[model samples]
Target: MDRSFEIQCPPFDLELSRWDTVFPHWGRSFPPSHARRIHCFSLGRNADKESLVGHLHVAFHHTVQRVPFLAGSIVPSLEGGNHQRKVVPQGVARLDIRDLSHKLSFDRLAEEGFSQHLLAEVLCSTEDNTPHVCLFEANFIDRGLLLVVSISHIVADGRGVTEMIKIFAQNLCKAQAGLIGYPLETTQEVYRSDRRRIVTGNGVPGPVEAHPALTSAAAGTHSRLADVGTCCRTYRIGADALVALKKAASSAANNSWISTNDAISAFIWRSIMVARHRAGFLDAGNEVHVAQPVDCRALLGLEEPYFGNAIYMTQGSLPFADLAGAATGLSAAARIIRAQIRTATAERFRDVVGCSERAEQEPHTRMKIADDVLAGGIILTSHFKFGLHQVDFGPAFEGRHVKALRFPVRGTMVGAVIVLPRLPDGSCEFMITEQGRTVECLVDDVFCRFTAETKTAKSVLPPSPTSPSRNGQAEFVFPESTSVKESTALNMTTLQAPHTGTIKIIEMNRPKAKNAISLQMLRQLHDEVERIHGENTTGGTRVLILASALDDVFCAGADLKQRSVMSDAQVEEFLALLRETTCKLAQLPIPTIAAVAGAALGGGLELALCCHLRVFSSTAVVGLPETKLGIIPGAGGTYRLPRIVGISHARDVILTGRRVEAQEAFAMGLCNRLVSHDSSGTERGRALQAAIELATDICGGAPLAVRAATGALSLASPAGEEAAYASLLHTTDRLEGLSSFGEKRAAVFVGE
Candidate 1:
C-alpha cells in the first residue's frame, strides 16, 4: 500500500541501456525528464467508470509486479556518476479518475477540431509533482471516457509500452470474466530486462562516423529550431490513397518491389519537402536528411516483449529538388528510404551502438547529438505496428468504441512527423509538428490535393481568396471578370478590362499601411502569382498590370512594425517568400507592367524590378534603401537591379540608399516610361492609366505570338528562336494574320 519508498542500492538499481543513455540525458532536451510518450484512448459512451477505474488499478498493480520497473524512477547510480544511470524500483503506479460529464463531450471535441487546449484538458498533466510515478489519468465525459497514459521513454519504447498495455488490458478482461485476482500468464523465460544484451559489443569502441543528427546542428541546418513557435496538426490518409500510392511507386520504380511503409513514408516526405520549398523554409539547392527510428529488438535478438529503449536511428537523405520534383520524386524518395532500411542490419546496429557509446563519453559530442537530434532536417516515427487499434478494455462496455488517440504535446522539435496507429480499415493518421507558418503552409499543400477525400478532417487553412477546383487533381481557378473594381480579398484585388481580352490589373490596397508588404500580404501575392502561372498554359491571361490603390505611394516596402515583432526565423522566411514571389512574377509568361506613382523603396523597388516594364509618374521616386537599415535588398533587388540598369547605376542606387527621381531613374534605364501629371488624372492615376494603355497595346498583338516572343527572349538562344518560329507555323492565329494582311482588314484572332 506504500507508494513512496526510500532509494536503495544493489537490487533496487537497474542498469541503463545504451539506447536510453543516448536519449538526451533526462531533462535537457526532454522537458521535466527524458522523453515521455503520451497516448489517449477515447472510450465512447462507456459509463462503467467505477468498475473501469477499479479494474485499471487492479490490472496495473498485477502488471507492475511482472514488470517492476514500471513503478520505478530513473536516477544516476551512486557509483557510476551521471554518465551511467539506473532505475530504482519505487512502489505502485497510481491511476486517477475525473468525471467531467458536465463540462465536455466527445461531440464537442470533434466539433472544435480536437484543439490542443481541449486536448490538454483531457490528457494527463505534463507537470507531475511525483515525477517518479508513471500513472494513468481517466477523464470521464458525457457519452464517452478518455484514458491517457504517460510513460518515460528511458524505461520503454513504443513496443514495450504496447506490450504493457496488452497485459493490462488482458488482465482487465480476465477480471471481467470473474478472474478478479488471477494474473494473466506471460512468457517470463523470453522476457529480458538486462541492458547489456541490448548492445552485445566489447567495451572498447571504434571510430565513429559523423551522424546527420550530430552534424546538422553544427552545419546550422535548423538554426531556428528553438526560436520557432511550434504547433501540431493532424491528418489521416485513407486506405485507397495508400493503395494508389503503393501502386504508383511500384510503377515508377519500373515494377520493382516496394513496401507499403516505404510508399507512404516517401509520399509524406515528398509532400512535406515540397510544402517547405513553397513556404520558403527550403530551396531547391539544399539537401534534406530524414531520420527514422527503427525498432532494433529483432535485429538485436531481443524478444518482442523485452522492455527498454531498443530503438536505433536510421537516416536517408535526398536533395530538395529530387523530393520536390514533379516526376518520379516519390519513387526516388521511397527507394532511398528502403535502401536505408535494408542497411539497418544487426552489424550496422552494433556499429551504431559502439559509435553512440563512444560519442556520449565526450561532452562536446554528446551535447551536439542532443541538440541536433531534434533540430535535424526531419524525424519520421511510425507507430502503426504497435497494435493500438487492437486494444480492448472488456466486453462489458463498447470495447471497440475507441474513437481517437491524441498525444497532447507541450513542445516539439523541428520537422517531426509522427505516423499514428492505423484504423481498423487500414487508414493511417499523422501528426505533424513544426513552426506555425510551416504548419500553415503544410495545411495549404496537403489540403489543396484530394480535398474531397478529407472533407471530414479539420482544416487549419485560412479562408482562401480564390477557391481552387477540387475536380480530380485540385487546381486554383480564377473566375472570369469584366472591367470592374474587384472586391477586396485578403490583400489585393483583381480587375480585368472589357476590351483587353484577359489583361488583368492587380491593385495593391492597404492605404493605411502605405501598401507595406506584411506576411499575409506576401502569401496572398505569392498565391496569386502561382495561380497566374498555372493559368498561363490555358492562355487565361494576356497581360498583368501591377498597380497600387494608394495615391501618394506605391509601397513603403516591408512593414517595419510587423518585421520588428517577428523573430529572426520569421524574418528569414518572409524574405525568402518575397524573393520567390518576385522571381515568379519576373518569370510570368505574359507581359507584366509595374506602375510606380510614388516612393518605391527597398522591397518595393525589388517588386517593380520583377515586372517586364516599369511605368513611373513624374512625382515617383525609386531606390533600394535596404542598405540604410543595415540590410541588403533580399527580394531579388541586388541581383535584378544590376541586370536592369548597369552595375554602376545599380551600385549608386543601392550603396547610398538614396532615392532616385523618376527622370533620373528613366535616364538610367530603370523605368520604361516616366509619365508626367497630364490633364488625364492625378500623379498615381496617370501612372496607372499609362500602364493600362501599354497593357492594352500589348493585348492587341496575337496572344500566342506575344507569348512565344517572350519565351524566346527569356531563353535567348538559337534553339529558342527556332522553336518560337516553329510554334507559330501551325497556329490558327498565323493564318488569320495572313488573311488580315491580304484582305486589308483587322484580324479577330483567338488565343490559339
Candidate 2:
C-alpha cells in the first residue's frame, strides 16, 4: 500500500510554439536543478487512506489524459526549422506513496518546522535522472496525509499548475461521488496550452530597444550559484505594517495611491540598499535595479486555464541616495516601481516578444541585463494573490485543508526575493536569498520595524535589565529627554515637554499596580487633558503622546484589587469618569499616539484605542478581556474596537477574551507600528522613542492645518470642517506652503 515506483504516462506527442522554444531547453531545465513547483497539502487523519490514494490515482490518470502535453517529454523539434523543441510521448511522470505513520506525525513535523530533509521526504526531489515532467509523492503520517504535487515549469507556470490541480480535483470529486470515468467533456473549464497566443508579435520593424530588465552583465542568464555567497532567510510582514507602509508611500508620492505590493517592494528594495551599504556591497553612487515578473495572461487577453509561461519581466532603477535616503526614500522607490509597471503595456510586451524571437534566432543577439542586478540588487517575485494558498484537493479526504504551504527556492541567484502567499492572518512571508553579509545586515531595527518575524534579527531582543518587572517596584525608565524639557507632576501622572517642539507627553506612573487605571489616575488624566486643552488654544501643543512609565506594562486595565473593594455604585461612577476621560482623549485637538510596550488588556486596551495612532513594542500583547470577567468593554471599547479592527475582529477579540500577540495585534490594525527592541534602549523606551519620532514628523507640518486634519479624522461636523478649512486660507503658513511649492523647496511653517 505504501511503496515508491513510477507510474508510466500514456503515449502522445505535442507541438510547441515559438514561446516554448524561446526558453532555454524549452523550459525543461528552467532553473537547471530546482525546476519543480511543489504544493504540499495536509490531510488530517480519520480519512479513508486507501480510498483517498485510489481516488487521487484515478484523478491524476484522467488529468494526464486530458492535458496530454503534461505527460510528454520536451525533445528536439522534428520539423527542424526555427523551432528548438517539441513535446514527445514518453515516460513523463511518476507517482509514489510512502507510509511513515509510525515514524512521524504532522504535529511533530510542524513543531520542528519544515526542514530541507523533511521536505525532501514529504515531496521527493524532481532532480531524478529520469526526464519526468511531473512528480507526485503521497506521504502518510500520523494525524494526516502529506500530499505533494510537483509539476515541471516546462509545461506550465504557477497559474497553469493551479488550473491543472483544479481539473485533477474535479476528477477526484467525481470519483468520490461513485462515478468512474466521468465524461471529460463535462468539465466546465477547458485546458488551453497553446503558447502561440502570446507569441503573436512577428518581429519589430527595427532593432528592439534594450529593456532595463535585461540590461545586466549576464544578460538573460541568472547569476551562477557558485559566484555569489548567498544565504536564504524568511521574514514576515504584518498587515498593520503593510497598511502603514502603503499610507506613507502614497502620502510621499503626493497621493498617487500605490498598491501594497508596490509599497512592500519599495520597502524591500530600500532595506536591501541599506543592508548592502552596511555590508560594503554597494557604493554611494551605485544605481540598484529591481526586476519584477509581471504575469502576461491578463495583459495579453488570454483565456482562463491557459498553460505555459505568460510572464514578462519589468524592472526599475534608482540612485543609492534616492533609493535609500532617510526621508521619503521608500516613497521615491515605490514611485519608480510604479512607473516601471505602468510602462509594461501591451506594446512594450510585444516589443519584448519581438526581441525574444530574434534572440532565439540569433544566439549573439540575446538581451543584456544591468550588472547591478546580479551584483546585489533585488529580483522580487510576488505570489500574493496567485491562488496557491487556496489549492483544494476536492472531496477525497472530506475537504482539502492545508495547514501550511511553502514554496522553497533552492539554488536561486543572489538578491532573489519571493513574496509568498499570505497567511490566514493576512501577514506576508518573504523568502529572500541574498549575499551572506547583506542578509546579516538586514536584521537591524530600521528594517525590522516593518517585519513581524524578526526573532532571527539581533535588533529584536528581550526586555533590558532596566525594564520594570511584574511586581512594579522597579525604577521606571522613560525615554531620553533634553535638559531644557519641563515636567509637571500630578498625583499619578507626569506631563513633560521638550525644549523646542510643542509636543507633550503624559506618562502614567502608578508603578505599584502596573500603571492600572485607578480612580486617582483617571482623575489626574482628566486634569492633564484639561490643562493640555487650555495650552493648545494658545498654540502651546502640536502633538500629544500617551505612554506608561513602567517598561513591562502599559496598563493592566482596571485595578482588580481596587475594583474588588468598590461597591456597584462606586464602579458605575468610575466607569462614567473613565468614559468621559477617554472621550476627551479621542477628541484632542492635536494628534495623540499611545506607546504600548507590554500588556494592554480590557480598559487598558480601550484607553490605547482612544489615541489617533498606537505604537506597540515587539513585546506587547493586547486584548479586550472583559468578556472573561462576565462583562463587556464599557469605556468606548464596544464602539471604537469595531471602528478600528472591524466588527468581526472586534467580536473575536472582545467576545472571546483572548490575548493577541504584538504581530497579531498589528495585523488586526490594533496598532499603527510595531517597534523592535535594540541594544541601546529598553523595550518600553524604544516604543516611546518611536512614538516621539512619529510626533516629530507630525510636528513638522503647519500647526493649524494639522489640527484641522486631526479634527476631520476624528469625525468633525461638515460645517465645523468647512470653518476649519476657511480659517486656514489666510494664514501665513498657507502662503508659505504655496510659495514653497512654486519655488521647489520644503515649506517652513510657524504656528501661524
Candidate 3:
C-alpha cells in the first residue's frame, strides 16, 4: 500500500546563512546530489498505521511552525546575486507513507542489510527535480517503522537535518502525551536573526579551487556510474575493539595521543588501500589521498542551534609503500591524517573567508574530484558525533528507538565512507559505498582478519614470538639490509667550463634514478652556477647549456622518496631553496638552454621552464603532474607557466596533469626546438649534442651586443621594467656593445 500527501506549512520567510549560498553552486554539476538520511526506528510492537500517519502529520506541522525553513521553498537571492539564496515558506511539505508488510518482512531487512527494494523506494533521482524536503515512511507489519528523509543538500547540511528531526520528534512525543503549549528552546525569529548576524559579519566563504586530482576523480566517478554498480555495507566495531584499536594506533605511533575517531579512520583508510591493492586498482608508486569533511561550526564560533553548511574539506596523502608497510605503519598514517585535520582551525576558517571575499572580484571555475582518477582514495563523512540515537521520538518508544542510520548510496559516490553513531551495544558502524570488488575484498579479507585478531583481549596478547612485542607495540623483523659502495655526492652534477669559450655546460650525472634531483644535487648546481657567475669577470659566457648525463631521462623530478621522510618544516626549507635557485638561474646575465632528453615532470619541468629556451628530444615528454599527488607545482610553475603559455593553456595542462610529448610541447610553444635521434642509430645524448650546436651558432654573434640585446628584450614588454633597469646604461657590457658596433671590425671582447 502507498499513500502521499502534503503537510501544510506555517507562513514565514527565512534568509539563508552565507554558508548555505555555496552549496547550490558547489553541486551545480551534479544536480541529483543531496543529503539522503535513512533513519530506522523500532516502534516496539507495531502501532496502528492510520494512527501513526495522523500523529506524524500533526508533529510535522507543529515542527514546521517552530522551524519554518523546513517547509520553505529555496528562492534565488533577490539581491541580484549579491548574497546567498533565500528560503521562503511554501506552506506545504511532501510526505509519502508506504506499507511493505505484505511484500517484505522487517526481519528480512535486518538479515539482508539494506535491501535494494527498500532502497529503491527511498532514494531520489535527479530527474525527480524535487527541491523541497521529502519525507518517506515504510511501515513493517508487527515489526517497526522506517523513516527516510531526503533533503536537498542546498537547503541544509547534516546538522540542519539533525536539528529538524529533534524538533519533530519532541513535538510528536508531546502530542502523543496530550500536552498543550510546549515551550520551544529556539524560534524562527531567533534563528533567522542569529544567522543574519553571522552572515553579515563573516560573509560567505567560496569554494576553494579544485585540485586536478579532485576534478579527475569526480569526473571519473560521475561517468562510470553505470558500469560500476554501487553498494553499501555496514561494518560494526565493538567498544572493546575500539579501545584495542586506539591502543594499537597509539602504540604504532610510539605513544602518541590518538583519538578514537582518528584511530578508526586510519584503520579504515589503510584497510581500503589494502583492498584496492588486492583488487589490482593500486600500484607500487601510486599514492592514496583521503579527503575528510570537517565540521567548522565550533571553529567559526557559531552557536549550536545555527543550521547551515559549516564544513571544510581537508585532505591528507601517503605513499603506498609507507602506508602498507609494517603493523606500526597505521600510526604514521594517523599522524598525517591528524595534521591535515588540524589545519581546520579558527584562524584557517577566517583566512578562508578572507580568500572568498577576495575571490569575488575574479571568479574561477570550481574544482571537483573525479572518481576514476582518485588513485585509490576515499572521502569520509562522519556523523559519529551527532548523537543520532539520542533523537527520541517519545517515552512510548524509549526502549525501542533508532537502531541504525544508513545514508543512501548514490552511484556517483563510489569510495565514499559514512561514519555513523554508536549502536545500543556501544559498537560503531561504518557504511562504505564503492564500486567493483573493493568492498567485497575489504569485507572478506581486511575486516575479517581484524575481527579475528581482535575477537578477545587474549587473542592479540603476548604478540607473536617470532616478531615479539615491545611495550604494547608489535615488533616485526625488517628485511635484510642491502649494502652498496658509497659514491661521492659531489659528482652528482658536473660543470664543464672551457678555458676560453662563450658557452658553459652543466650536466646532471645521477643516472641510476633517472637523474631525479636530490637536495644535494640542487645545492651543488646552485653553487656551481654562482661560482661561474663570479669567475666570468668579462661577462663573456653568452650562453649556458644545461643537459643530462643520463641516457634516457633529463630529470624525472624531485627525489620524492627522500622528501617523504622529511618533516613539514624541512619540506618548506627544501622548497624555498629550490625556488631561490630556479629564480637565480632565470635571472642570470647570460641566456640558458635546457636540453631535454626524456621525461621532465614536476620540479624537473619547472626547472626546464626557468631557462630562456628548451630543446626537446623526439622521445621527450614534459608536464607538471603534481596535482595528481594532491599538491600544486610549488616551485614557480603556477606563475611562470601562465606567463610563458597564456593563462588558458597553462590552466589546461596544470589542471589536468597530462603529459605533453615533444611534438605537442613544441606546437604549444613549450619547447624552442625538437631534435630527432641521430641517423647513426645513436639516441643517447643526441638532444645534448643538438643543444651544444645551437649554442655554438649563438656564440658566433658579438658577445656584448648579444648580452645587451637579451637584457633589453627582457625588459621591453612588461611595465616598470624600464625604471627597474634604469642603471643598465652605466654597465660596461652596454658601453662595450656601442663601441664595438662603431668600430665594426669584430672588436675584441675585453675582460672588462
Candidate 4:
C-alpha cells in the first residue's frame, strides 16, 4: 500500500563562489532545526504518465543548470584556519516519486492531506551527513499531482528557498512554452562574499577556523520537538478581522501604528495565555515571553534577493495577568510586541551579527536562552511576506500556483505559531502547535469572539513623554560611590576580607582605564592569591570573589595603551606571567567566583574563565577579541573555553571575537549565574553584593568537603575521573559527610 521510489541522477561538479564560503559559518552554528518545508501544489487533471515524466526530467535538468548550488554538497573546512569550508556543488540531486493512484483516489489525497510519517520519510530519506537538495512528487489518479520540494536548512534559509523555487518554476514554464532558448536575464546573479556588507571596520581578520558540530542546546533550541499527543491545526484569520485587531491596538495607544504581524502576534499570545489559565497551566505571577525571528537582510543593506541565514531571533516579555483579562489586555500586549520589534534597529542587528561571528570563532560556545525563559516561551515565525502564492509552475499544470505551504512540527515545546501567506480570499492561515486542551480552549467561542469583534471606542490615549535633556544632549550621571580609596594592608591589589576572612574579595583597582591589567597589576594579583592560599591553610577563607572597584568595568584585559611603550620581550614576559597567575588562581583549593559588571576581554575574560564559577551583571559582556587585533587567545583561552562550553561554541567565540552578554553567557554555561542591576543602585554595587552573598552561601558548606569536590571536578579535563576518584577516596571529608547525613544535622568538621 505504501509506494515510494528515489532516483539518484549522475553527479556534477560545481566550484563554489565567494558567497558560498560566507554561508559555512551559518551552517556550522545553526544546523537544520526545522524539517524541510513541504509545499503541496495541485497539478490539475493528470495527462499521459510518460509525457509528464519526460517533461519533468527536462525541466529539472534546466533548473540544475540555472541554479548549480542546488546540486552541490556542503563541505566543511578540515584544516584548522580562518578560511571557512567551501560548498562543492559536486553531487546528485535525488528525485522521489510516490504513486498513491492505485490505493487512493485524488479526492481522498486532497481531503486527508499528507500524513506526518509519509512527509518525513520523503524528506529524511537521505542517509548522508552532507547537505543536498531533493524533490518529491506524489501522484493521484483523479484529482491531480502533489509536488513537494525539500531543501536543506544548511544550504539556504526560507528566503533562499523561495528564490530557488521561483527560478525552477520559471524554467518549467519556458520548457512548456516550447521556447528553445531561455532568457539569461531571468537567471539570478550570484553574490560574492563581501564582509563589508555584514560587518564594519577591517572585516574578518583572517581565514575562518573550522568549528565542530553544534551542541544539542544551540541546535535543538529552535526546533519543534513536541510530544506525540500534540496536533497541528490551521486557523484562518480574515483580512477584516486583522484590520479590526490593528485598529483596536492603534486606538488603545496614542498615535501608535500597529503592524499586522504585531496585532496577530498579540492576539495569539493572549489566546495562549487564556487557554493556559483555563487549563490550570498559567502561573499568575510569572511573565509570558514571546520570541520572534526577524529577517535582517534589509537592515544589513543587502539586496532583498540575497541568499543566506540573515535573521535575528528576538524576544519580548509581558505580565501573564495583563494578557488574561479584558479586551484592553490584547491592545496592551500588542503595544509591547510592537515596541520590541521597533527596537531591532540597524545597530542592534549589527551587535547580534557580531556576537554570532564571535561565537563562530570559538570552538565551544553555544548560543541559548536561559532555562526559565525557554520552558514556557512562545515562538512565532511569520512567512506572509515571502510571496508564496506567486510561484507558477507552468500553464500545463492544473492550479498553476502553490495553494499553501506547511512547516513540520519538530519541537515539543508548549507554544509555536507559524503564520502563512494570505489565501486568494484574503484569509491568512496560522499553523498552531500546542497541547490539545490549549487548542480546544483557544478555538472556543470566548477567544474567537474577542478576535472577531471590533472595538467601537475612539478615545485616543496621550503619548508618553521622552526624558528631558539640555541642548538635545543627555546629561551624564555618575554613581554615588565613585570615589576610590586605598587599602595599605594589601598594597599590590585591593583585598577586602570581610566576614572574619571567611569570604575574600579581591577587586581590580585600576579605574582610569577600566581596570586594564598592567604587568605590575598581574604580578601583584599572583602574589596576593599565593598569600591568600598560604594563609587559608586552616580553611579560614572558604571562598574567593574576584571583582572590580570601577563602577562599569570588571577588567578590560591587557593594558594595550601601556603595552605600546613596552619592548617586544617585555610583552612576551607579561603574557607568560599572566598565564601563570591565571593557572594559579584556577588551581586554588577553595572555591572561586568572578563577579563581572562590565566588559571582560582577552586576558580579562581569561582570568574569569580560570575561576570555578562566574556571576555576571545584566550589563556585563565577555569575549576573547584578540583575533580582531590579528592574534589568538594565547593565555589558556584557546584550551579552557572549549572545556567549559564545548568545542563548537569555543571555536565561534575564539575565531570571531563575539561579545557575549549576561543572559547569553548564563545560557551557554559560561557564567554560573546572572544578576540584574537594581534601578536604585549602580550595576557594580548589585553585582558585588550578589557575589558576596554567593560566597557566603559557599562558605556555609563544609570547607574540607568543598575543597575536595573542587579538586576532583577540576581533574576531569587532564587525568579524567580516575584521578578525581583517587583524590576523593583519600580525603576524610567523605566519612564526615556520611556521618553528618546519619546524624541529621549540618556537617561540622576540622581539617583533619
Error of 2 at 612 (Å): 47
Q: Write the per-residue lDDT of candidate 3 for residues 73-174, one digit (tens) a residue.
A: 766676634434676766456667777666554555555454433555634433335567545454443365667776666666777778777887888787
Ranking by TM-score: 1, 2, 3, 4
**Candidates 2 and 3 compared by lDDT, better number:** 2
Cα misplacement distance, residue 285 of candidate 3 (Å) = 0.8
Clash statistics: count for each candidate: 0, 7, 17, 42
Q: Please, what is the TM-score per model?
A: 0.63, 0.57, 0.55, 0.50
Candidate no. 2 TM-score = 0.57
- Tens-digit per-residue lDDT, 1-752, candidate 4: 23343333333433332233433344332334223566655555646554555555556666665655566666666633353454554565655555655554434434444443334443444332435555545443444555566665545566777777787778777777776232322234452344335443223322222111112244554344422246556555555556555665564446778888787788777766766554445666777777676776677687656555655556777777676555466678788788777766666655544434444454433323222223355767788777778778776666777655666554324466777776665556666766654554454313443332111102211111122346663222211121111121112223333323367788887654567886556765888788777875454667888988877788889888768756687688888888889989988978999989899999889989999989899999999999999889877999999989999889989899999888888888898878865697888888888888887777665565567668877775656555655665655566777888999987765554
Q: What is the C-alpha RMSD of each candidate to the true structure, in Å?
A: 13.7, 20.4, 20.3, 24.3
Residue 366, model 4: lDDT of: 36
lDDT of 4 at 382: 83
Ten-residue region with minimum lDDT total, candidate 1 = 478-487
Model 1 agreement with the true structure over 173-219: per-residue lDDT tens digits: 87777686534332233223567665654455454443333331233
* lDDT of every predicted structure (CA atoms): 0.67, 0.67, 0.63, 0.61
Please say which candidate is ahead in lDDT: 3 or 4: 3
| Candidate No. with top TM-score | 1
